[model samples]
Target: MRATFMFRAGDVRVQNTPDPVLRYPTDAIVRVVRACICGSDLHPYHSLPETPGGTTMGHEFIGVVEEVGADVATVKKGDFVIAPFAVSDGTCEYCREGLHTSCEHGGFWNDTELGTGGGQAEAVRVPLADGTLVKVPGAVDESLYSGLLSLSDVYGTGWHAAVRAGVTAGDSVAVIGDGAVGLLAVLSAKQLGAEQIVLMGRHRVRTDLGREFGATEVVAERGEEGIARVRELTGGRGVRRVLEAVGHLPAYEQAVGIVRPGGVISRVGVPQYRDAEIGWPFFGKNTTLTGGPAPVRAYIEQLMPAVLDGTVQPGRVFDREIGLDDVPDGYRAMDERTALKVMVKP
Candidate 1:
């Protein structure tokens, strides 16, 4: 099989790799059908600390089940399924609490002892099949692939940002950043019943898409001016809820600045700063801050109906598609912001 790998910073290669096979009774082998390059993959692609060996890239994927070990029960051969970025037991207390990302028995594919990188390959070995794989029902087609693929990561991530912030009908919400996740956050905020969804991003392509996704307004400014814009929009009250989709310190600071006192902020962006203050600025405001890696498995059931019914189109974020061998270009396009998000099909 062939898979994407990173030998060093700024270099992504597709190379022949050993095919995956069931290593545990609870595992399954999946033939990759569709996969995507996530924004987080750029973390390592940029400058992750030196590793003795190159690293495998990619986590978001949907595929057809090829073989399952004896213990695997939730899905079987021929089933079309999606796997969250993390592998989970699904029966753990954390999983039960809808926080499967922290599943006691699970870890990220690249970080776990198994060291298997995900869906970027022609095939993959998935452990904890019952807990990790969400089988799609009925007919499958290329039209639905990107939307279904989104349930594995970006869509669920945005949903987390909105839900964690307690976005409700009649509430005014602002999403910080306008990357794929940020745009999805705008969609999620709308679905969760926000009366006003404001997107803060400067990119014309992304902000325009954000408007399509239900952002009632787009704020292209940043820092103090950005805060004032939100305040002026809300009659000097700021927004009632804020979804922080950019992990950079400036983005977080913007989230803090634009959110009204006593409002909540949910952050889904992978934070890049070493020090971020929450208490001091939040002092006396009773601000509630929540969010982390979205437990995508936990969200699949809640989010799929929308995808299946076409009520929402999270996959619209995917602006470019490439064959598996061309995944390196996909990475380059996303890194340069030439593409909102890239889809790679195997």
Candidate 2:
């Protein structure tokens, strides 16, 4: 089967690769129904050395199981399922504690030796199938694809950020970033009962979606001006919770700066730097910081119902759609900010 691979930085192409098959007793071979590009993939696309040839890119997808190994009982052939970005064994200690992303037996699909294949491909090998795959209820439909696919990563991740930020009814929440994850953070805050949801972004399309997702205010400013605007909106005390959806230094600082003393800052963006400076401003604010890669498997079950019931339409984040052959263009469009999120159908 043909798969998308990163030959080097700035070089992503669709190339012929070995077809994926069941590799473990708990594995499942999935014919990908839908896949999409992710922001994290852009890191390697722009970084050197890390841009090794043959690296498959992508982590979000929903698919139909073509085959399942002997021990996989929860799912079977022909079932539509959402494959979380991180593959994990359900019985692991970490998974039992609701931290599937850190499961002892968990592995990131793109980084494993098997290279199970990315969502941007025609098919993918899903390991620990019974543990990592969530069966979509009832029949699948066009409208369900985007939302179901999001359960694999962004939606759950955004919800995790909101939860970590301690969002609650009547609390003012500021979401820093307008990407799919950030926009979802706005939705998550509203779902959690936040009275005021402020989205900080520059794009009109993304800001529009943020409002639909529940953002009551939109601040297109950045740096000191952005901080001033957030403060101004919160009556100068700052919001009670801030969601940092962009992992860069500026976004991090903005998140911290816009929250009131004793507030919380939940960061969900993939950090680009090894060491981000945290000075007196961060410490003196008495704010609590929490976040890391989301444990999507842990939240999928809890979030699936909302998607099914149409209470949350996370798929709205996908503004562009393409086929497997057009994945390179999908990456370019997202890299250039022409699309909020791109959905690739195989």
By summed lDDT, the worst window of 10 consecutive residues in model 1 runs over 48-57
Q: Could you tally the backbone clashes for each prediction?
A: 0, 0
| TM-score for predicted model 2 compared with the true structure | 0.97
TM agreement with the true structure for every prediction? 0.98, 0.97
lDDT of 2 by residue, 1-346 (tens): 8789888777889988888988889899999999999877777777735455667888899999999999999999999999999988889899998888888877898866545778788899998898899998789988899999988899999999998888988999999999999999999999999999999999999999999999999999999999999999989999889999988888987887888998998999988767664677878888888989999899998999989999889999998899898999988998999988999988
Q: What do the candidate models score in CA lDDT, each in turn?
A: 0.90, 0.89
Off by over 4 Å in 2: 48-52
User: Per-residue lDDT of 1-346 in model 1, one digit per residue for the tens?
Assistant: 9998888888888999899988899999999898999998888788876655568878889999999999998899999999888899999999999899999988887765865666799999998899999999987878999999999899999999998899999899999989889999999989888999989999999999999999999999999999899889998888989999888899988888888889988989999888777777776677888899999899898899889999999999999999999999999998999989999988
- The residue pairs in collision within model 1 are none
